[model samples]
Target: MIEIIAISEAHVESFHRALDTVARERRYLAFLEAPPLAATRSFVLDMIAQRNPQFVALSGGDVVGWCDVQRLSRPIHAHGGILGMGLLQPFRGQGLGTRLIRHTLDAARAAGMSRVELSVHENNANAIALYKKVGFVIEGLQRNANKIDGVYGNVILMALLF
Candidate 1:
């Protein structure tokens, strides 16, 4: 069974592990590669201390996925948040991402966000499908948004409005 809950400092280590696993794959996610564990810990600490919520999917006490909704810090853009998320390889195709995104949207609404936005690599069909299933609409596309291994990729910008 998988449980979804807010991320805490106690979960930092596991979160970093899960992130590392996902980062090794170049098909999805915004990060070109994994950040160091110490950087991951500092990020988790800042999020938890600020009470800015990020949710995790757990199974057997291991972090299998994470959904992060980070509010725009600029005063004018603070009514919305940008989302980023990923699930472990084993958890894909199990509807876990849809579940995590649904929960993340709920959290965004509760946090008084007027909308949530995300960017998916244009080639990631599964992720784009899940985002659309969760009410995100394609807003625009950023050409040559990411370059990895000398290959440039585009990204589709999507958003869910409350």
Candidate 2:
């Protein structure tokens, strides 16, 4: 059985494990390699302390997918939030990303967010399609946004305005 739940400090370990697994894929996430467990835990702790909203899809006590709506701390950008999402290998192609994204967006709206933004790799057709299906529109294209192993990749900047 899979459960979608709010993030908590207790999930630190499992979240770290899941993150490392996804980061190792080195395709979707920006990280080129798995980060240290301690660093990952600290990051999660800070996210919890700031009341940032994070949700995870769990099965058998392991994190299968996760999403976050990161609110900016600067007063000028407080009304804006950024979305980040990822899923384990076995969980893809099952509409899990859509489910996670929909849940996160709803939560963000209820939290009084005025806008949300996300950047998807330009080559990721499926992700771009999914974002479009969820009401996000392409606002601009970021040229050479990511340079991995001497190869530059474009990014599609998208947003949802309320």
Note the Cα lDDT for every prediction shown: 0.89, 0.86
Which lDDT tens digits does candidate 2 get at residues 1-162?
A: 678898887887888778778878767777766578788778777777766778999989888889999898899999989988888889988988888888889988888898999998899888899999999999999999998778899999999997
lDDT of 1: 0.89
- Tens digits of per-residue lDDT for model 1, 65-157: 999888888999999889999999989999999889888788889889998998989999999999898889999999998998899999899
In TM-score terms, candidate 2 sits at: 0.93
| Number of clashing pairs per prediction, in order | 0, 0
Off by over 4 Å in 2: none
> What RMSD does each model have against the real structure?
1.1, 1.4
